[model samples]
Target: MRLATFEHLGLRRSGIVDLGGDGDDGAVLSPFPEGTDLLEVIRTGHVPATGAALPLAEVRLLPPVEPPSVRDFVTFEEHVEGVRRSVDGTAGVPDAWYDAPTFYFANPCAMVGAHDDVPVPPGCHALDFELEVAAVVGREGRDLSPERARDHIFGYTIFNDWSARDLQSREMQVGLGPCKGKDGATTLGPWLVTADELEPYRDADGLLRLALTAEVNGVEIGRDLLSNMSWTFEELVAYASRGARVRPGDVLGSGTCGNGGCLAELWGRRGDQDPPALRPGDTVTLTVEGIGTVSNTIVPGTTPVPIPSARKRPRARP
Candidate 1:
């Protein structure tokens, strides 16, 4: 089922995308027991099939869920190696990556929805977007095995991990974080497709078989089969759940796909043929087959939030 959270009558509502009415002029139906949000529905673990449908045009869509927390994992080796190569011309997915999935928490408060405007932070010379997908945790669980983790996935949503590459490049030199570089505006969705909706696409090995494509202003930048990911959602979730509670409304992202998903990787592969930096008025559309698409426009920020200066090194100890 395609589920969404939207504003209707000045109030936020959650629903299933109902296409059977008006011959394709589909509406969104608040699942049985309307008024509660998608997060509550996920926590419920079962979407009741009966509800009243509202015209799709009657509301403005919001990110499928206002996640309690977001953990984005770097599960694609090619993306890691390519990004690392672009940054330093060395360091393939380090042996540590092979040891286990690595991830970081993002600012859920900064999340936005499809067609939302992403403010281009002033001084961000190399604004970029990541083509990615995310799975929302259905309920709370800790110390889950990969086998158990698979059962807790509620649904999937498209994520455009907006980036400030130049700022990112500067920060990583200190070996700490992608902090301010990311944690800005990350786009989350047009809709959320429940895990059951994608069941038919599951391969024999239980990995999802779906295609992901990214486009900027009508130009196709990249495409890849999601099944190519080395670390499955199960592993990412399991790793994240180890000794830690993963609760309903939490999110886990499948980092960038292999090749051309971001400007830095494309630039490294193309040499001087770099794609232009994302700028005001530019639109980016990311689509995952079966799940849906999210298109966002770059807009100017009201004022530049000055970038913080890195701390200077202390005098060498004698």
Candidate 2:
């Protein structure tokens, strides 16, 4: 089932995506409460079959899972190599990178839904987007074995790990990791498709069956088969929990994968490229094979304008 968190009639809710409907006709029933988002649903370990009514197309889609408890390793090799090539002139994944699956924390408060206008923070001129696949944990357990990893997975979603490359490059040089660069804006979903529903897309050859793509302002920038990933989702999960607990709603991002995955891969150097970093008018669209598209527009920030004092106002005409 493809589940989602959405806003309808000014109230937040949750439900399964009804692909059969033109607008409101096909949404399957799910009983969700007011302001119930994906984070709440996943935490409960279940999704009911009824909810308040709304046209699926009319409602705005939020990240499939909000404020996930844990986010695990980024295991895509092409992504690592790409970053290394751009930053360190190295073309191979480091031995340390392979020693264990690496993980990073993404800001839950900054998570945004499809079609939402993302705020481009001031002084950040090198905003970039990363196309990735993220999985949510369904059950909780510690030191999970590879054979048991699949049992812990609940669903998958399209993720855009929006980045400030300039900041990222600066921080990584100090070996402190990606703190400010990665947490800016993490995008997920049109919906979260359950693992059981993706049976047809799961292959036995250690490759994901989905075809992924990314476009900026209607221009295609990234495209690749999920099969290109050097590491499998199962491997990522097993490695991540080697000696730790992996809980429900723990999101495992696939990291950026292959050519055109990020600005660094698309353009060799920062200023060497012609097009400016993502601007206010830009629209980013990320689409997965079975699942639909997740899109967001960049907009001006909401800094309050200064109000003139009453003393500066002219006296009202009597």
Single out the weakest 10-residue window by summed lDDT for candidate 2: 267-276
The worst-scoring run of ten residues by lDDT in candidate 1 lies at: 23-32
Find the candidate with the highest TM-score and give its number.
1
- Candidate 2's TM-score reads 0.85
TM-score of each: 0.91, 0.85
Question: Pairs clashing in candidate 2?
Answer: 29-49, 30-49, 30-50, 30-51, 31-50, 73-102
235 in model 1: Cα distance from truth in Å?
1.1
Error of 1 at 245 (Å): 0.7
lDDT of 1 by residue, 20-57 (tens): 64633665555445567788889987766656777776
lDDT of 2 by residue, 1-318 (tens): 878887766767777776764543665435376556666667676666565555566777777776545463566676776666665456667888876677777776777787788887545667888888888887777787767997887888887888877767776887878877776688877788888877787777756789888889899888887877667787778877777777777888888866677777655533254345788889988888887788888876544356665576676797
TM-score of 1: 0.91
lDDT value for candidate 2? 0.74
Report the lDDT of model 2 for residue 79: 71
